[model samples]
Target chain A: MIRFDNISKRYPEGRDALQGVSFHLPAGAMAFLTGHSGAGKSTLLKLIALLERATRGQLFLDGENLTRTGKRKVPLVRRKIGMIFQNYRLLFDRTVFDNVALPLVIAGHRHQDIARRVRAALDKVGLLDKERALPITLSGGEQQRVGIARAVVNKPPLLLADEPTGNLDPELSRDIMRLFEEFNRVGVTVLIASHDLDLIARMGHPQLRLHQGRLLNPEVLAPPQ
Target chain B: MRPPAALRVYFLRHVQVALNSLGRLYRAPLASLMTAAVIGIALALPSGLYILTDNLQRLGSQWDGGANLSLFLRHDVSIEQAEALREKLAQWPEIERLRLITPQEALAEFRQLSGFGDTLDILDENPLPAVLALKPAAEATRPEAAAALKQRLQALPQVELAQLDLQWVKRFNALVDIVQRAIWILSALLALAVLLITGNTIRLEIQNRREEIEITKLIGATGAFIRRPFLYSGLWYGFGGALLAALLLALAFVQLNAPVRELAGLYESSFRLHLLEPGQWLLLLLCGALLGLVGAWIAVSRHLATIEPG
Candidate 1:
């Protein structure tokens, strides 16, 4: 449920990061955002996340105008959205259980609720046995699973992943894609940004491609299997 | 779905997190003790100066009451003339207390007080003049009033010379003023030193924990959320430091109390050192907490902005 209407972003050094980009994805829909390096994929995601303001034009999330939202309200808006990073940004100093519990903690969940939800999310990632292990002790694939578990722990309506499997092997990448599909099947809107065309093609999801800071084409919905 | 009492839950959670950070401090007792000790020493310098000033003020107030002026009659004046002059001077509204000493009584007092009673027995005639000791009202104890009164007494026909005993009081007041100004300057310098010490500590902590902070931000943790624990840690440092400083000051006062009491006894007076009042303790605690909070805030604000999530 995000809409970017002719949004453009220009850095102070006169470099255009995003130029006249526009797109819309409906509620509970899953799509893959693809572009080459410096093609403005991150800029588009940043605009939607309200981490960066657009230089021109309006952007909306779930029908609320993000372009007009003040700085103080950004945190509240972000609380409703979950983000997973390519680096698997687990807190190395904390246990796997604590890493997954972070989103719920930020959402101010009760202790009991947080424990229950975190355990369930960890179970979903098949890491229930390693709950007490630190991220540094985990394999790369396991760390990514921790990131995924954290993203879904809050049960947010929207999930954004920036190159979720960019650092994973082919087998692990497929497994992570399956994890995203499972969440999408349960009605979470998911948008993943990546340069992995083959992976997107294999997943057979709708594609929104970006080229030189502009949306290159309308949504190319996958044909029926 | 909105929870019925989410804000209370959130506040409790924040407190829990703060306590958890405090627990970490407790886990490393030696490091915690050293940090707190440094903070205590920084706090103690000013606090000790304040106590000293307070005690000096009390001593000054006690001595202020004993200030008096002595007027000696001329050698040719008779006892009856000196008595009449004393009675007339006692009528002045500024005079609080007065005593007339005849030449014979003055000579006797000098012999007893100066420890020359045996030697004075051999003298044929008394050399001391009739003396009038006058204690002025509190408002009239200023240097100007005492000088004017001395001039008036000296002009009397029955008087040889009038001497004001206010010189000691003036010197004591001057010393007290210098001590007070020194205390103010010392407190100001020590406060600045405390701020710098706390700031440097927080800066080092930031450098050490840079990776953890970057990771937290990358996971969408708000700056406030990431900064909360560090703030609490700073608060703990301040609180612990102030408590130690207070204890150290109290111990010092305890150590000095006996000697001070003995010295006062030598002068046939009872003097007791004053401990810190409740208000002073509260002020110390407040100062510590504020310093910790400010130091941590400055450190976090300066370094947190430079970290970017890749």
Candidate 2:
């Protein structure tokens, strides 16, 4: 669950990355943040992840005021939100299993729990057989799948993917989108930031569009007025 | 969780990380050994100097001339009177033991030692007077008390002169003190060198792993988690260096042992270099490990804060 109340993030160089964007997505909702380049999609995701602070207004995620949450509590907040980047961001030296096990390890889960959860997540992403292989050995789509498995391994209540399929072909992109849909069916709130409007529109999920750093149509998605 | 339970888990994780760090080092043996070897040499110098000074001081203290009081009898005192005087002096609490040397016995020892045996035999009258060699109580190690006791011996009717033969002992004690101070200064400087070495190494490590660190932070790894491996690796470096230093010192001691013994024999001295005690060795190891930890900590605290996930 995320609620942004007129959040505006201004960079130090006097550029407004996001301008007064207001929206609320309730629990278990899946949506795409559709926008062009520099339309503040990544910035919005970053603000929600507490990677960047809003220059003005507030952000609330799962009942906690993220705008006011200090840096010390950022890690605890982030533990609840799984994140994926376009580049996969997987450690090249780590094996597939290790990348998937990263979140559980950070949470201090014991060996047995981490192993079991990591294997199940890998199985869901169809990467179980490549668990021992390093990220460098994997294909682009397979590496991105490893990133997906890692994001979901911890079973975080919320998932944020920034350009998850930006590097994949159309078919692989569809497969990646299907993986996200499977996660959403089990009730994890998912927000994806992407510029692939045609592909996202075919999925028929609710869309929150941004133009020139402004939420184009907050009225369509704001919960109950 | 209860505090004890939490602490136990925390320590277990730390131990795991420590071993993992060591494994990582083992994966790069040459680099790790080279770093540790430098640290080892730095540590070994001070440890060797400390042991050397310690042995010298021990040797000087064993035959402590400061504990001895020499009482020279008057020339008029007969051997019987000198024997009576020794008995009288031996009864005092200050005198632990006293041995009387009659003039005839003294003359014979002088003739043998002074290398003028034939010349001394031609003299009509032997010049050496009867003497009593007294070992004072343990309290006489204090120079003032020894001097007071010497004055008491000189006041005796049969005694012509009494003095403590501890001038060389005092000089040796001062020399040992100076050596100890110098060792401390050298140790301090070398400790700084070790700290800088470890700090620079950790800094370079953090730089090489910048991308890994950024990814870890992005995936919600806390600062403590990111720091654990580095700190443990630093400790391993220290631990390895300390072991190497101990090994080096032991080898040196073995090589020097026979020669030292031979030299002592030539001087007719009963002194031999004592091997390092267990406690001293433990302390050296601890010092090396602690220096490594501190160096790593300093580097991490300074650099890790600058690396934040974006």
Candidate 3:
């Protein structure tokens, strides 16, 4: 679903976040991206989400050349993408249902369809009961689940999560990882960026390791545990 | 054929979000009302001043009590000569009409109207002078032309002093013109003030919801969708302010209407003061709403571009 030919990103402040990075994740495939802090993992994910553009090279997202995409078309391109953040990034002032309903709302779905899909996504993440609760009132794990539900509510063909379980305990982290696997199993391409080498190794998905803005390894593709 | 399902979805979502934000405003009555009141006050002052200026302009133009000039002939001028001078002036193109009022004629008219007939008749000799009352031509009715005609009449050997009744009208016209200009300038400045106030309010709202905007952008919310609520907020602010201003003007009109009518009646004039016209009221509302929408749009475009979910 994503192909990058030596993508490089350099900020105006003389910081080179990524350089000579290239990778391809086939449709319906799932993979983990492991890198240290500032290892260009977030930058790569941003490139995929169209939040940040590659300074050099071409990127093909679902066979569409995103490198030539105009700013006005970015939002339309992002419709097929679901992005998650380490902070969960849920709107704290809103309830769980509202947070989960955001993607569908952004997609301009009808109210009934939005409600049904949001509930179903929340149920999938095991947080359907907490729909009316505020994000501030939820536990760290439950909040992350809410984020997951929000990400999947639109049923995006591509999912990108940056430290999805960053704040969760080991058990909750495993549960989050399992949720990702389940989505992947259902043919949604998933790419997760994390610094947790052990958890990623145990998950047994293919790994794309970034070191010093370079793709040191590509496509581990070990069978799932 | 049925309409596209996507289009139906979009319409429903728009209604939903717009009503949602409106409900949000209703839920927090005090703060919302405060903002609206500020907008209303800003709009009301200029509108009231403008309406006042309009009525004053009407009154000023209606002061055409006829630009009549009275010339007191020299004491020694005979009634026949005064009559001859009147006849000569009557034929002039500048003179609309001329009447010779002999001393006795003036005295008799004064006595009948002044209710002091006996007192005036007690005098041994008539003290009133022969007077020539003249109305200017249509083109000479303007203040400058009337003054020029008066100057020419004063140069006549038989004329003593020329009194132009249009002087007070000239002064009043000048005063009204100044007031109208001042009101227009005030309206422009206050309109700008309204724009800034609304823009600042929208900017602050965007700042408060920065995270939400960023998240929405990341979730593929289009530019129009993201801007919809803020635009509506501005519209509400403008509309609410306009209503408040209209209400204020109405109240002011009510309190002033009776006194104005009584004053006009005292002067034996039929002039009546009225509030803003119906068309004017609609225009004010439209201007307010338009300003609100523009202010919000500017703020959204400037700030929303900076917020990205990276």
Candidate 4:
């Protein structure tokens, strides 16, 4: 679902975020992106999400070239991927239901369809009862589950999470990772960027390791556990 | 039995956004009212001035046909001779209507109006001369034409003086013209003020909702989708401001209408304050809504691009 041909990104201030990065994750595969802080994990995920463009080389998602996509077309392209953030990034003023309903709303889904899908997604994340609760009132793990529901509500074929478990306890982190595994098992391509090497080892997903803006090596691919 | 699903959805989205914006305003009543009131005052000043000038223009046009001339007959000119002159002048194409006011009738009118009846009764001979009042034709009502008519009438063999008070009438019309132009200039400035006020308000709103905007964008919301609520908020501000301005104008009208009617009554005129017609009210509302929409559009386009998922 995602392919990068030697993608390189450089900041305007002459800082290199990613250099000579090339990878291809076939459709329906789940992978973990592991690196220390500032190891270009977020940058690579950003490239896939079209949040930022590669300074050099072409990037493709679902067989479409993202490098040549115009700014106006970015939203439509982004709709095909569900993105989760470490902070959950829920609108605190809104209820958990509203937060999860956002993607479907953006897609202009019917009201009944949105309600049905939102409940199902929330149910999948075990946040069914907290749908009407505000994100501020939810615990850290619960808030992350709300974020997960939101990301998968529209059922995008590809999901990208950036340090999604960064602020969670180890148990909560595993629960979040398990939710991702569940989505991946249903044929949704998933790529998660994290600095937690120990948690990643337990998931047993293939690893894409980076160091100082460059991929380290073609590491051994781990079968899904 | 209803609209297409897509059309309904589109319309419902707009209604949803509009109501959401209104709800936000409702939640913060004080700040919203303040901003809207400021806009209202700005809009009311120009609109009020415009209505005043419009009324003045109406009053001025009513006097357009009063461009008449009064010809004073010579002291020795007999009633028969004055009557002959009046008949002859009445035949002239320049004169629309002519009336011969006899000396006795003139004296009686002057005594009654001037409150000098006792003093006038002491005089052996009537001091007032016979006058022939002349109503100029429409074509002769122009300043130069009226002046020429006056000069011709004054040069008559049996006439001593001819007066046409067209100058002051012309001056009043010119003054009204100047005031109308001033109102136009004021309206333009106030419209700019409205735009700036709404733009600034939306700018502040965008800043406060920066995180929401960024999060929405990050989750595949288009620029237009994110802009919808802000635009609706602007619309509400402008629409509310217009309503307040209309109320203010109505209050002004009510306060001034009675005194104005009394003043007109003192002059034996039946003129009353004119209220805005339905079309004019619609225009005011439309102007407010359009300005609000544009201001919001500008603020959203400028600030939204600067905000990304970063």
lDDT string for model 4 (A51-115, tens) is 88899998889989999999988989889999999988999999999999999998888889999
Best by TM-score: 2
Interface RMSD of each: 2.6, 1.2, 1.3, 0.8
Calculate DockQ per candidate and list them.
Answer: 0.39, 0.66, 0.63, 0.67
lDDT (CA) per prediction? 0.82, 0.89, 0.86, 0.89
Give the CA lDDT, 0 to 100, for residue B173 in model 3: 63
Runs of candidate 4 exceeding 4 Å displacement: A219-225, B1-3, B62-66, B69-165
Candidate 4's clash total is: 0
DockQ of candidate 4, scored on C-alphas against the true complex (2 decimals) = 0.67
In the range B1-310, model 2's lDDT, one tens digit per residue, is 5577557667777888888889988998999999999999999999999889988866765674556888898999998888888888778987788899988899989988999998987899999999899888766655567778888888888989996876765676678889999999999999999999888988898998888898888888899999988888788888889999999999999998899989989988888988689998898888888898899999999999898777
TM-score of each: 0.80, 0.90, 0.81, 0.85
Q: If the candidates were sorted by their TM-score against the true structure, best first, what order would they fall in?
A: 2, 4, 3, 1
User: Considering summed lDDT, which 10 consecutive residues are worst modelled in model 3 chain B?
Assistant: B57-66
**What lDDT tens digits, residue by residue, belong to model 4 across residues B1-310?**
6569888998998898899999999999999999999989988998899898889766754554468789989999999999999889979998889899999999989988999889888899998899998788867776788898898988989999998988776777678778888888988888888888999999999999999998888888998899999999999999899999999999999999999999999988878889799999999888888888888888888887888987
Question: What local lDDT does model 1 show for residue B137?
Answer: 69
Residue runs of model 3 more than 4 Å from their true location after superposition: A219-225, B1-12, B61-171, B268-271
Q: What C-alpha RMSD does candidate 1 show over the true interface residues after superposing them?
A: 2.6
Q: What value of lDDT does candidate 1 attain over all alpha carbons?
A: 0.82
Estimate candidate 3's alpha-carbon lDDT, on a 0 to 1 scale: 0.86
> What clash pairs does model 1 have?
none
Candidate 2 has an fnat equal to 0.57
Candidate 1 structure quality by residue, lDDT tens digits, B1-310: 4465777797797899889878988988998888888888889888988899889767765663456888887889888887788789878987887998888888877887999898888989888888888887666666777677778778887778888877776787678789889988987787676666667777777787788776566455677887888788788888888899899998999999999999999988777888788999999988987787777777778877787554
